[model samples]
Target chain A: MGTGTGLGRVRGLGSAKKGAHHWWMQRLTAAGNLLLVSWFVISLVRLPNLSHAVVTDWLSSPLVAIAAIILVANVFWHLRLGLQVVLEDYVHNEASKLGLLVLLNFYAIGAAAVAIFSIAKIAFGSAA
Target chain B: MSRNHSRPLSPHLSHWKWGANMLVSILHRMTGVGLATVGGLLFAGWFFAAASGEESYACFLGLLTVESGAINIVGAILGIGLTWAFFTHLFNGLRHFVMDAGAGYELQTNRHWAIAVVAGGIIATLVLWGWLLWPAIMGLVGGEG
Candidate 1:
């Protein structure tokens, strides 16, 4: 509520010194997921086949691999932020809530890592 | 002091009138959770299978496809359910963005948007899947003839 640019104020970097950083990032990544996931669906639909070779060939392209990695990152980030809100709302206990939040971080990061690694592997090993 | 102070409680679900808006609001969360868990794992599995080599990829496809190369029942169910969830969340999320921009608060407007979003999500899913599953549909249709 205090003086500063609207962006700084919403960022909680204003004189009031509060922010909606988490909430802001959630919305930001949601926008990303919307685009990336749509690309995934449409691209898959356009593919001639779902066979391993076709899929691998698709991901082998640098552009496709990059997009897939970006999609994975955005999806996992949004998943973490969205679930964090749900867990915080429903889990009343401080300790239990913290634990679940921590576990959520692990799962999101791990899954994203695995997915990205797979794409990179296909790009380097098979696609090459 | 903590024990002596009673926390104020907000009204729960029973306090609100149930409507399409409420249903969509709840489903946004429900479908989000479903996609985060089942859809997330399945996505990771697809990538992992592809990276593991041709044999593993074939094995993974085997789980999703039948001898006729049509999607198996499990695959079809999961595919439909996931698509519905995906589009529902996507549409409802777009609705939230409009609301966040400080419009669409009228009761009639909200109700209409809720109905439209739910219907639009289903129609979008069917349209996309219909195109993708045309071969499978024809396969089954030919058998009946």
Candidate 2:
């Protein structure tokens, strides 16, 4: 193997893959979370009481239901992205970093799923 | 491999620009932790209010409202924390959007936008607090009659 050939290859090289999609998603989810969070806060403040029936009634509204779903999804997505960056920055051990990243993704997904399911049950089920 | 190993690796941390991106990164984590803590507290309050009787719920409301100045202080802290979290996340989210659209990559633009984020956060917090307090002020004056 000649050194000259390897040098030429290195000079012309780019990354083995692209990460634009991931970057785009991180931004998109952040934007979504921003909007959802504002709605969530305002809605919470507007709620007159914390009675079960009242809570359910508010959630059962079509607009509130949709916003809650989006809020849950975007929250989880943003959490995953933020945690991934923290892991990448602080964890030098590749194996550990990857493991934590996988775990974080699963946790975020599970939490969001549970939240959405609870909201749906409260909003659409007989409880409402 | 031997020759490559002889060269020292460049410091990864050194390349990061200690400006808007860094600030956003740190704020993201801070707000995340803040949200989690506040969310947990809110959830606990919900659970307590749900499980307990109306008396307990009334007590909770009392603490949130007609209590001593300490309660107001706590409320203010939470309100400010929440306001900062919201605005920081919002501005940084917008920054991410612009970056995604292939703008603001230049150094000067990046710094300019970073400063804007800081300013936006302050202004947003002030406006939100002002709005929230307006009702309280009206109530205070109205009650004096």
Candidate 3:
């Protein structure tokens, strides 16, 4: 028998040292979501119109555009982290879990990319 | 290294009575999944429409919140559902982070926080929609008077 304690023997068998980083990032992004989402909700409420031109015009503002980008990025990252914990806890099949996790990452990245691209298109496109 | 049969297998839902805390925890995960999947798709669509041009953007707006019609009814319901999901998940997630910081572990406090998350989420959604519809409501009132 190894001299190490029971938990010590089993610890490294399941995971490495990087587990804390996921927890930390989840919390950090949660805080970011709180702030950015508050801004988003309040901004939407204040908008005078939801019409295409007016909405796009509002998004064109530099600060709004940057904040919107950051909000979507942080929101999606936080979302992915949360879903990961659920999947890890519930998924019994190793291969299936791995497949779903890979898909989740791509989905989040792709969704965030589309949102950022749309914001950029509006913010930088011709004023007319 | 032999498997210890004495260790109880994974705890299943049937083994324990359902409680408010458990419900909130389950909902937190469920909403997170919903937001990532369904919400993400609509979000991509919104951005794509905006980037495409004014006509497409108008169509997207019509698809979501157009006033008065069958499509409007369906879109409104989906919009409200999405809004509620967003608020509930956001609030409950904050509560989870707070608990992670080593507080609110007492049974009473845990239940209270769970209830707060539920109630607060509903109220937040209502107030947001109320603000969004305030002008329309006022317009109706003005016309009636």
Q: Give the chain B TM-score for each candidate.
A: 0.87, 0.67, 0.83
Candidate 3 segments exceeding 4 Å error: A1-15, B1-6, B67-71, B134-145
Best by lDDT: 1
What are the per-model C-alpha RMSD values against the true structure?
5.4, 5.7, 3.6
CA error at residue A15 for candidate 1, angstroms = 8.5
Weakest 10 consecutive residues of candidate 3 chain B by summed lDDT: B65-74
**lDDT tens per residue, model 3, B1-145:** 3447888788889988988898898888787888778887887778778888988987877876655522377677877788888999989988988898899999999999999998887998899888766767777789642
Candidate 1 deviation (Cα RMSD):
5.4
Supply every candidate's count of residue pairs whose N, Cα or C atoms clash at under 3 angstroms: 2, 0, 0
DockQ of each candidate, alpha-carbon based? 0.67, 0.22, 0.68
> How do the residues A26-88 of candidate 3 rate in per-residue lDDT, one tens digit apiece?
889989988998898778768876667778888898998998899889988988888788889
The window of 10 residues in a row where model 1 chain A has the poorest summed lDDT is: A9-18
Global local distance difference test of model 1: 0.90
Model 1 lDDT at residue B124: 93
